[model samples]
Target: MKLFFLNVLAILLRYTNASASFQSRCLAFSPESTIFNSTLTAREYVTKGTNLTFPDNDKSCNQPFQVAAANLCRIALHVPTSNRSSITMELWLPEQWESGRVLAAGNGGIDGCIAYDDLAYGTEHGFATVAANNGHNGTSGKAFLNNPDVIIDYAYRSLHTSILQAKKLASLFYGQKYQKSYYIGCSLGGRQGIGAADRYPDDFDGIVAGSPASDFNHLYAWRASFYPITGKNTSADFINAAKWVVIHDEVLRQCDTLDGVKDGIIEDPSLCHFRPEALLCQSGQNTSQCLSSAQVEILNRIYNSPLYGTDGKLIYPAMQPGNELKASTGLYNGLAWPLSQDWYRYVLLNDSTWDASTFNISTAMLADQINPSNIRTFPTTLAPFASVGGKLITFHGGQDQQITSFQGARFYNNLARGMSVSSASLDEFYRFFRISGMFHCGSGPGAWVFGQAGAASAAGIPFEAENNVLAAIVDWVEKGKAPEGILGTKFVDDTVAKGVSFQRRHCRYPFRNTYVSGDAKEPGNWQCRGV
Candidate 1:
């Protein structure tokens, strides 16, 4: 009885001491006192802690609310430079359940809010997480107006600075260096991950990029060209929300079964040769379910014509075929996408109030001269990062409405051709996967869960080992066992805890998940076969 009491007392004492140490260290966290030379902006312990809800006060961009975290210390820093804009960073450190790892997440759009949701997601998984506003304070392109320094910071400098300072903070707080570092991002965040590999090769051991917005200048230019051909009043204009559903159905009907399966997802989008003209109204049989001749032409222009540079070089690949429904309502319809519009207005013209209607492909091409985000994220050279034992895995949704999967495909092809390296050689340090029916980052009708943290767990994969993309990357980096394929789960009710409706083992690029004589809906029934 006496020994038991003594052991309990010792455990209590250790817990108390650790708690006390955390509180004391939290108080001593001063950004200016850090090893890095930077002016401290804000230092405070978030007593309420981390939660996913966007705060009411700062609801401008649906910013994630930091409300229920325990022992959370929020540190902000500003590293000034010769330019007008400075590098600003936010580091979120966990007081308890420290994973001894660091995960740096990235931002979206032109918004300057630190990715609070990603930070919270990382902390929940016991990782010390950090994010930046890409060097601005709000979700507005107005910040980029005539500020070259700000643009430079937004391009790649801010994330690099954030990662460096965050690692320093992690070392200081834990009293031991982090064992591994990883990055998770989609869209703009995806672009930033690739940028890190290029500029700061040794920064992270592994990177997870989804739907990367690479080839910045050309992407915007190509996206803008669609407006001239499909604007509301243009001669070739043909898409509307109602008409798009008809086309969406047609695409699936034509190609959804090419993988020897009858599920909704088009497993091999590359093999699906869907023709839009098939849906064109017959003669004068105009109906809401059918597209007119003008509309067919517009769809063809958007999906078949590759944007070319002034020198006749291919600039951007054509948009994919099956995403017409999403494009018609969310991103591109009969007009320009707002992100593409803002790139030309603020980043290029330096005019926030510039009329988007006045913009055209020619003007967008001119804007490339001032492309501040000219970071070669998809460069031919991976020797620097690869030599140091870095691993990178990227995935793109086949139906991504914002940044097309073709963009990723183009980069991979370019890298292979540019370096004269075989695809197998590139797979040593890099792998790209394509999710069949997903949209931009997440959401859609596909088995969209890949165990990526910082978002809702929808993949019904029960095991922790199979569900987290960050964990998978960490295993690859530390254990050196590269992933052949990642399991994807679709929840019955689109949730993680709910029963899995179906699952698919998404094969890495250059391979297709072929159905081989079994239940079509079952993941085990498919084989990852080469194209």
Candidate 2:
């Protein structure tokens, strides 16, 4: 009996030791050891927590990844004597992995949560992704002034430091140096991607920036200007949400059929020669349903952006027709407006009492005070970005209502100019695709088709029934076969609600998809018309 008991005790001890060994092995990669080159050190790894969540596939209901959430360990590097500070960050690794590559993403506005979809996509592809809150967290515009640290971080340090620390961590964990590095983001993320390529070309190998906010200062100032018009008792108040619906309906009635089918989707908003004044109730007999004169003027300005000269020459394209009302949600209405107001009042004027109403469009030099889109000042020259051999691909929905697709086009054009290259030459390093009929980011009231899953969302636009932009990025980076054109579809099943049925071709830059002489629904009915 004593010998038998001794044997049992030995087995128990062995089992306990094995379990401890497994736990230690899982935590082999520590963030502190991950250093960028030999000069910088990663701050301590901080585990935010973990959760069990379903994978991207349908079986996610049954089998899920042990999702680990962590705050990137960071070193706060002071920028000279300025109030601004930059952060060097190391994304804490999952407990299971010994080593993984790093993906640095950019944040939008004042809120700095790495986009949930982007993060899921990156981690699933076996990358440890990192991003910064860009200093302050509320809304970017107002937060910049209230906290000196926030503005400085957003200005330059956040991107600079994050890259340095991420590289260091990669070396520490893998023992082998990273074979390749990539960057991916849209909108503000797009801006950051460009900034890195132009400013710190050596940081990444491939970058995918969609709808970049290149001119940060000008864009923010423009948002401030629009907020007063959209908010307050000005003409915008008369138009309001209800009027937006009416305008949307009118735009659909006039241009929805331009694509050769009355499928409720506008194949091209640019081709939509819509005039809101046509909807106005004849002369003076006012109806609550029809727009007032002030309302009509406001709609025109909102849709037409700010006029640069007397001839009504456009400085920037206005939000497309169907997108006027949706800006009230997410960062656009909630964060952007309040923050812009705060910046105009507190940061610029140093007087919180100043009313936005007092500012006049014709006389006031708002651009001088708060400019977010000054390319020259914050220019992203391709030389810096190209030297690193980084690849960047950007996509924006042509029908995007929040920030117009023109913004993407303009940035790409500027990039090409800065690089001293033609569109064809840049195609090797960077690419842009304008998804037709899709809304801001990815969600909208259109039938967007991808893979074999017919129409994915109620607001999804149908073209290529299963072509996902995120998936395209993965294919592009891993395979090296650049996407030439993406397929778009139009839905037909639910008559009341549009469904994906017809396919359209989305041509890359310098190549515009033009309708053939006969059939518009047929894919062969369109050809790439190069500029």
Candidate 3:
């Protein structure tokens, strides 16, 4: 039966000729026969510079091209479920393909669409990139709760189904199975990548998860826990965001030069000790620029320590320096307060009219009963991920304001413990790099934009940080060379004019780049320092 279906699909594909006019459709084939059971249609779209006449011949695979824009094809899949209605998926595939690798990125919020740039880059590299809306689309956090399908999809099913379908589609298009598959994303996408590794270990060979929100239930609870202080307060009145900025500024001010260069980037935020109250506005002055007394206290709580158990042991680490408070909105903030709130109110409580402002943090403990984020409920364990010899590289900006880098560190530690793999042994299968000044999947003022300054200006030269990450992953996968320490480059447009030169170094884990001796502007004078 499968052979018959393949023949039919081949005949159909042969006649189609990969033409621009050919319908970009999704077909549900029988798992055994690969015969079209049903079809989900996709709108014909085009990426910048894509030639429809080329058919499935995507030449961008071997060439370097600047991404001006991306053409996206979105489709919804009704995945079968025993307990819920049906799960819906928002799948994105770049219209052109130059390679066979498929990338699946997870969205941060229930509302925000997929990371378009990430998908564009993947498609440009000849990979089919897929991202899902995680069930429902809404600004409210309570939406997921009322819908059984949404919860199931958000939990794991939707992404898994999407990946399976995407791979099948790729097989049909390329006439060959994907040579290799990879997943790259941050925050929620990070979580999705790890989730894939745990549940469906065979999905991808390489995964780059930046600051994943692994402990979904506990982390959501933590956000609700903070609502008591931050929910009502504006940027001026809120203590959490204000104290975070104060800490961030103080860290940069004191440690900016620690790396032997004061180029405005903090090489390592962990090295800097920050005091929030030190920057408090004088007396009664309260505005967007400064924090008030109440705000400072709240910040202290956020940074000082996590809520502990009866044994006084730590449950979670405090938010690290360099992260912005607002980043939480897109990644952490939206997930915790808005997304989770909407889920709880609408799905579980069936009360769409419930006021979010009235949410009581004191009752947060009850969340476990309503929406359990326990790891046990997850379909897969960390064992299969390591067993299959998969390669996972995760990078998070230390200055991310949303989901904390500490969370990534904590997840790694847990994985290390669960897998019984030594830190060094785990490096063979998984690695995490923390970028000191970057923010949320490589954006924000603190983000290191290597080569951003036209490749000719000293002040705006691109840092080779992100590109190095891409390189390291490729080398690790194809060559079996596990990245020991990644080399980071700092470029200066006018090196001769400034009497300086570009510097490069291998940044190790738990250690940050620091200056050992000599001029601060020079990169060679820096060393990786441990906290």
- Among all candidates shown, the one with the greatest TM-score: 1
Q: How does candidate 2 fare on TM-score?
A: 0.73
Worst 10 residues of 1 by lDDT: 49-58
Candidate 1 residues lying further than 4 Å off, grouped into runs, are 1-13, 35-58, 67-71, 81-83, 96-99, 233-237, 283-286, 457-465
Candidate with more favorable, higher lDDT: 1 or 2: 1
Model 2 per-residue lDDT tens digits across residues 369-450: 4543222224646765655556667777766755677666777787778778888888877788766667765445443443
**Per-model TM against the reference:** 0.92, 0.73, 0.73
Residues 1-531 of candidate 1 have per-residue lDDT tens digits of 999999999999998787777777877877577745688776666544434343432355676455534556777677764447776677878776455789899878766777776777677666788887787777767777777778878888888888888888888777898878889888888988988988889999999887888887877777777666777634444566877888889989998888777777888677877788898788677578888777787777777777777767777888876677777775556566677777778888777676666766577667566667675365877778889999998898888887778887788877778778888999999988888888888877788887654655322444343555777787788888788887777777686666777878888888888889878678888898877
lDDT winner: 1
What's the C-alpha lDDT at position 195 in model 1? 86
Candidate 3: RMSD to truth = 9.4
Residue 431 accuracy (lDDT) in model 1: 87
Per-residue lDDT value at 520 in model 1? 69
How many clashing residue pairs are found in candidate 1? Answer: 8
Error of 3 at 461 (Å): 11
Ranking by lDDT, best first? 1, 3, 2
lDDT, each prediction: 0.76, 0.56, 0.56
